[model samples]
Target: MYDFYKTISKTKIDIVYLGETVCSKRKLLRRDDWLEIAEQLKQSGKEVVLSSMALIEANSELAAVKTLCSNTDFSIEANDMSAVQLLKNKPFITGPSVNIYNPSSLKMLAKLGLKRWVLPIELSKEALSDMQSEKPKGVETEVLVYGRLPLAYSARCFTARSHNLPKDNCQLRCLDDPDGLLLSTQEEQKFLVLNGIQTQSAKTSNLIMDLHELINLNVDVLRISPPSKHTEKIIELFHKTLHKAYSASEANRALQKLMPAGGYCNGYWHGTNGIDWQETTEEILCQLS
Candidate 1:
């Protein structure tokens, strides 16, 4: 894990989100370990944010959230309401899991100390423009430009269940599939990915082709959810594209080769089926308008 952070630290990624946002049972790194990593990343001139789990089911989990929220050194990305409540009056970020769907919700959270909010994965680009227009004075907007969309989270451990093991006694099988265990449809079509309690899109959400639209929308940040492999290259691709060193088309083609077996999807951003991919063209942009 240290080596992974050390490697990415040299990349053009500006902000590094640390800590486990999924199942609490995956405890290879403790709170101290995360803080140490955060320190190292900060020392490397990268802004670090500690992320909390999406679903805080137990008292132990709630306690863990409290510990993260109390950290004076780093800001917390509140993934759950419990983390949000604990982080009230403190400058913090709301993760993608927290539903800030409208201007009203954004306003409410901002009043409670929302420094920034990640647009929900399912929201269309049109919706983002609307939110941005009414976005508060000091708050920032962040979009997940890349990664497999984290669709949902349940108390149940799907990874463990797949292995025919109960949640409590289940071995930490999620480690075996670091990216995620891909699930397929009846006809053997790639469907969704099972990562413990979280369900993610089988196809990666790639917005390399839509960087122009995002820039036009006045987005504050472009987030790339780190996959297990080729993360440094992915960061470099986005960096070069963002800096105009590489055109979006060239970067998009390069990204295709780096992605896993499942193809790419950007339909959710188009306000359509999440699994479908639509090429960004002047005609398509006009229709969206």
Candidate 2:
């Protein structure tokens, strides 16, 4: 992924999140490897945030969290409350998996030295507006503006079960499914993707269509979770949308071709179903015209 780091460092995205934020069992990169990649990203003039593992179940995992927290050089993305406690008094960012649903919780985290907070993907735009109304100063808001939505995490490895292998003995087999192991419904419709212990939505949440609303909400950062393919292209598309170089409909058209087979969804943004797609007024007008 160092090659990916080099590619994104040249993109228009301001902040880059490094480090593994999901299952800790997948040890593709060590702590030093992450720091070295962090240096490379920082050298390319990008703000780097070290992301922590979301589910820390073992004592060794806690030890890893301690190591990441003590780095002191780069800011960290607190994925769990334990991480938050470790990050107290330090300027750190909160990942979307962190249950920061209410304004009271937001205020409490702000007091604990949170520099920024990623909106929980399930929270609607209206909910974010209400929360942002009472958000503390100096705490920036980041939206999961692109990529597959991380729906859930579990201690059990579903991918291992697929191979009929025990979780412990299952070789790092998930690496074979780079994007994720696609889980289809009984109806054969593409449902969710299993990435180790994390379950992600099959539909990519493309919010280039909602850039206006985000800007109006005063969202500080727009986060695009990396997919296996077209990572740099997606970043460039977001850059174009952010700069008003492409209208939402035009960008949506261009983006549709780039999406994975399951396609895009923004139903959560509209406060509806998570997996459904809701079209914009422009797209509707285009359809009629």
Tens digits of lDDT, candidate 1, 116-157: 999999999999999999999899999999999999989889
Cα-lDDT of candidate 2: 0.89
Q: Please, what are the lDDT tens digits per residue for candidate 2 over residues 1-289?
A: 8788888888887888888887787888888898999998898898989999999989999999998888888989999888999999989899998999999999998998998999998999999999889999999999998999999999899999899989998798999999999999999899999998899999999888788889888999999998988988888888887887877778888888898968899999989998988878785544543
Q: Clashes in model 1: which pairs?
A: none
| Deviation of model 2 at 173, angstroms | 0.5
What are the candidates' C-alpha RMSDs?
2.0, 2.3
Worst 10-residue lDDT window for candidate 2 reads: 280-289
What candidate 1 gets wrong by more than 4 Å, as runs, is 281-289
